[model samples]
Target: MVLRKLFRRQAEPDVQIEKGLEKTRKGVFLEITRLFDRSEIDDELFEDLEMLLIQADVGWDVSQRLVKELQDRIAAERIVNPADAREVLRLEMIQLLELATRNRKVKILQRGVPFVILVTGVNGTGKTTSIAKLAQYHQGFGRTVMLAAGDTFRAAAIDQLKVWGERLDCPVIAHQQGADPGAVVFDAMVAAHNRNVDVLIVDTAGRLHTKHNLMAELHKLRKIMQKHVPEAPQEVILVIDATTGQNGLVQANEFSKSVEITDIMISKLDSTARGGIAFSVAKELGTPISYIGTGERATDMAEFRPDTYVDSLFFGEGEGF
Candidate 1:
């Protein structure tokens, strides 16, 4: 109960989440909200709700399970009004997210040693931009941050991190393009210690997930980091583009096989109409989503709260609690 109240207050008027979900709320979810306008709940209601959930890119199995659970709840509670049914649906969705995230709290920044984060994803997943946003986020809390340009496969990737580091006034450690990423990680660990940086965000190559050699390289980077900080690379965060829908799940699974993915950060949420990918991610991936990229700006990032995320899909700012 206390947890619910705390989140309720935090989510009340979160404009970032509201605006991020505008496209989704105004899209298929608008059709979903209208489903409750009818006076009665019937078989057709369940069927349509299930269909719309699948259309919204919630996974097939998850959509079926959600509808089934909702039907059982309405039956047990003797629900008749559509408004009441809608409320039931909302609670059910929240429960799904809560179950997935029950014990997977976001990692807290440890004192003393640099909190190294190893970020990975496929090309075009906005991996670099998410790293920038995360750095700025920690800086908001007055934590000093540094960036490691470990994605040396592409010169552009190195340059991108340098640009963000410059823009945020954070120092970046980098070697030349096509340089060994292990060397980059080793130097970054040394640099982080020398500077006493609170957080070190390391960027990794976004080579295609199917490449066995790429996965091998990630393992090598992890070994290099451990030699420096013992528990270095404290977190392996996988960035999944929300616009990829179910395909993002595939990426997460593939990366998890290579490295222990501690958390997920969904990017491009504002650009996708199918925000339901969050639901699928929560239900399918055991790893909790730690953050989300709401927009293009460095400030357009927020900790992933299920209540704030789900409510944003149905309500605009100041609406629907």
Candidate 2:
């Protein structure tokens, strides 16, 4: 009962969380509010709003659902003012985003075994760098971590991961270029088990989802893990580039078909990319987005929280919460 109370207390509203979400909210609101002004709502305004949502990476189907709901509410209530319409639309969008944010907690590592996490994504999505940042984050929490350079297809990938491991003072397992990724993972698992490390983050090759051989390779990695530890690879996180916008959704769809993507980590959100794609991906795929990379810093990544994000969306002027 005491521990439960402590957990409930920690669940209280967080102001810093709202501050972190401000980056995503500001980008989204800028695109959305541009459609409305002092002018009255009209057919042109509706069309513009629809187009804006699509361009912001909100999929057509989800955008239509939002527009339809807004139209219904406006028609029933005789709403006309652009400001009022914007607020109503904002509220509806917030509600839709809330659906994607449900159960966004990351699973804690169980005791007495290394929590294996297999990271994979297309090249240029920041998979290896994100893994390093994640290692730093977990290490800050006093967890012993080992990284595996399973992307032996590219020599540069292996070198980059090794650089990160060295900088962070963590062990990294790697093989020669063009080697089997599964074998690298196997070696890493052996080292992790022998060293009794708290976590093992395996970095896999990044290939386009359309590439059948690459997708098949990921399947083989999973099969290898099951052979050693049935419950290993506790989490398979797909690192997505926020700048890709709507195209990210297509990648998510294809990857999900090939492997069970337990969570999503959207990176490079500090740029001009409208971060609304995060909402669309979560809404469409029904996968919990556990974390978001705001900047290149190791501490830039943050846990996704719905209430904070909603606050940032509605109250744009203030410091989120």
Candidate 3:
């Protein structure tokens, strides 16, 4: 059986998310959608569903749990039709994401207080670009945003951030390369505080997750942020490359070991066919995805909503899954 294509209209936000997930919807998830086109659910259906989910980069544990939940729901609800079973599966997936994100409160920037966001990730994960996108997001809210070049290990990192600052017309606080990162953070905190910047996004040097010393620097930066705002560094956003699939999960796991990751931003989402990393991150890491880098352009970003994300993965361009 094949998935059905129908003509329908989608909301603007849903349309953007659907376009961004086009690769994934046409990839492994396409197979999963076809699996539900059958007349009845069976053991073979469950097996194929579980395998397709894992192939999509949903972690092994999360895939198993989803399948088990589907089975239990089918039995308890006496669901025999494949279409009905598929709806149950959708609810389960949405519930998984909603549960993971339920505890988060909306971020509000108080007057005279700076909302600090510390971004971290391994090299080549698009951490700097994600920071730029985040700054643009805050700027959209009519809030003044400042950037801090906390990654003092590389001169190029500092220069790159300054370039972005110029493009955004936002101020960037930095020091000479190889200068103390703590000092940079301290100065940024002071500058943001005195300037009454509504939002402050700090960029850290990209390092392998296994590097202990580099991870320790994150702890020191958090301390510097605390000195200015009693509970500053309010958001620690981790950027992960979607194309890395399961390897991205490993990076998140290792980074979480060092500091509290308040949110996640999956970069290069449009480039990956396997978009299931969002599920694994939400399920395994217990971190809510705040934003997704939908495309290469700095403005090509979308605030992640669980319902929109799940729906886009299976349905798009009037296709019914």
Candidate 4:
């Protein structure tokens, strides 16, 4: 699908996000030419090109391998034109991203059991807002959905989810401040089951990915859910901020060790210049990104589609995927 269609009639274009991409693309294009424009493709040029990619946060190993592959392809084809070289480089980068963009759709909810999705991330990563948007998405599909404010550590968190519930007209299960998040989740499960809701999304507290104690708390929460429903918490989603760049990957790696992160939801994509990090996360971790939050609006969340994303990044103008 084209990028234009992906966002077609969805809403107004986000001006700030478009401006950010414009600036990022300018830098990326300059880097591409500066690194590849001079002289013939040689060993030294390849090494320099690799360095450029690494500096862009592509990671050292991947950059080296990509440069090698490009050199070999160019050498074997005996390509000489600079424009052709640029196109080839673009295609290769797109192909690398294609690996992660293969499957972008969310998994279908299981029958007879509410699809339970637990959202987690470090504080200030937009976890709460992502949950609200997700609820709106599911509600639009005509699915009966319930939200659980399992981040009982913060009273404001409960109120935040409640606001979303009220806006979407969906039921929300929450507790007082300092309440056990696990207990909240268990209550939510019972409520969802009784109401025969199609989905139950639980919002958890944002903790540092490096915080051992906080990570352990997540483990305990999962164990409690298992006690109530053995196969509960069917989907553990990690909400990542795209602007954090490589640091986002570090968070994903750490969180994956603590909980089985079945999928990812990248937020603030429109506001970040480092959108390529999405490809890096997928390529390095092998976890498919299910959705992306393009803006702050509730309807701005869209299913991740590789073709549309690649087109948007490289072609600069096209329909949505």
Candidate 5:
């Protein structure tokens, strides 16, 4: 119960969450609200709801399942007025999200010998910023953080992480650009062990999920980490750009095959109106979104709490506790 309350307490204010979801609410839920305002429950109303979900990037399969579930729920509850279906809709969405977030508490800074997170994603998914935010999130709890710039393929990637390391005042391990990434990880393990770091986040080069060679290389990097410290990488986090919509889902699916992605992080959610993609990815890919990038700053990231997220998305500003 204490852990549960602590989890709930860490939830950002309804205003903040709602603001982050503004585009999605206005772009999708508002239309859904208007559909609920109609007096009759007709074929048009169902079709419109289906279209709304798809337009919000909820994907076809999850949308169809949600609509069918809502229909069954309304019928079973003997809900007469279509306007009353708003509550039913809310309940059904909660259920759908719960399917993914159930028994899933986002882990951070657990007491251990340097919990490691391998951050990976394709190019332009805000992987570096997400790592900084993740470090900041754990630092808030007084965890000692270190970063390993294993993205040796790009000098810019190494330089960017070094910048964040300086800003965070955390040590970063890196070598010359074009150096072996696995070699960097090997040395990072030594630094982490010597410094007794609480958390070690490894940054890897961006690669297209379709590229078999790069995927095989990622597997090799993981094996290297495991060799040094058995169970070194406790979490494999795949950073995804929320604005990419259904395409993000494809990346998650493909990336999971190469690396055992333990969690998903959706970045730049504030830039998109189709945040419903969060649902489709979670349902179809079967990986929980551990965090969401709400804005540009380090503090803009928030844990993806399903309950408050659903409430904030449906209701405009602040949701009921």
Candidate 6:
């Protein structure tokens, strides 16, 4: 919810994330701004506030934690005017987000074996687009990128990744529909090594008929990559649909159980008002959010910056919540 609602002007991209989070910002801050009207800070002040946070998609545990944090700050600071406590609240929420990322930068390809990222998500989560944006993002840094259409479950997924591969001017190693996904990744790894590609992004199946099967397949894919480069598959990036609200947390948890999720990419943020799922993701999974989809273009994605995000959300003057 915060880092620097130190209430300053934000950069252009910050403004875009702020705009995309408008729905969530309004929902969460409106009630918070209303609470500021109270002259006294008491236990009753936070009554039902947990529910409010949950309604904003902040998740249950973090909501309770934020409320308790507010209680502690009020007593420690001898705060009377509820308005002065807003900054305290902001700091605590920022701490939650920061704790999730732990000040670590998103992993880009480094000098070594081909840096591999395995992307996974349920169907309709915009996994493919997130992969494309990720490739474009690395290409912006001048890295040689390649894509592997390991998503043989759906014919469309293969064609879509191929389209992105062509558009980004990167090589795409793929097998025909119904081919073994792990074999696809294995061949992609060989190609990446031969070509000295800096990054190899592998797209996996969106959904499998059984959870157990999906889990096994992911393990196979990981092993296949490691066969080529022991330390490869450096990051397992999970793309989630922001509009899925709290349910997205369940998806993250389920997938994490299947494969280690090192980072997150939230897609279609601009389309949802309840983008507070970002807070829940950090609190529940403790994974750094790599990017947020702000629009449809390749550049529509924004690398998440906790401080800039908070400043942008709470920036304007006297704007009624």
Task: Report RMSD (Å) for each prediction in the order shown.
Answer: 5.5, 5.6, 6.8, 5.3, 4.7, 6.1
So what's the TM-score on candidate 2? Answer: 0.83
**Local distance difference test scores for all models:** 0.86, 0.76, 0.86, 0.73, 0.81, 0.79
> What's the C-alpha lDDT at position 261 in model 1?
86
TM-scores for every predicted model: 0.93, 0.83, 0.92, 0.82, 0.91, 0.88
Runs in model 4 deviating more than 4 A are: 1-23, 26-52, 101-106, 208-210, 227-229, 318-321
**Candidate 1 structure, TM-score to reference:** 0.93
Q: How does candidate 4 fare on TM-score?
A: 0.82
Candidate 1, which segments miss by more than 4 Å at Cα?
Answer: 1-13, 208-210, 318-321
Cα deviation of 304, candidate 3, in Å? 1.6
The digit string of per-residue lDDT tens for model 5 on 126-235 reads: 88898988887777676889999988888899999999898777899999998988899989988987888888999988863457867877888888888867776888
Report the backbone clash tally of model 4.
Answer: 10
Q: Is candidate 1 or candidate 2 better by TM-score?
A: 1
- Of candidate 1, the 10-residue stretch with the lowest lDDT total is 4-13
lDDT of 1 by residue, 178-197 (tens): 88999998999999888899
Against the true structure, candidate 5 has what lDDT? 0.81
Q: Model 5: which ten-residue window has the lowest total lDDT? A: 2-11
Rank all candidate structures by their TM-score, best first, as comma-separated numbers: 1, 3, 5, 6, 2, 4
User: Regarding TM-score, does 1 or 6 come out ahead?
Assistant: 1
**Pairs clashing within candidate 3:** none
Better candidate by TM-score, 2 or 6: 6
State the number of backbone clashes in model 6.
0
Clashes of each: 0, 0, 0, 10, 0, 0
- Which portions of model 6 show Cα errors greater than 4 Å? 1-13, 37-45, 103-108, 316-321
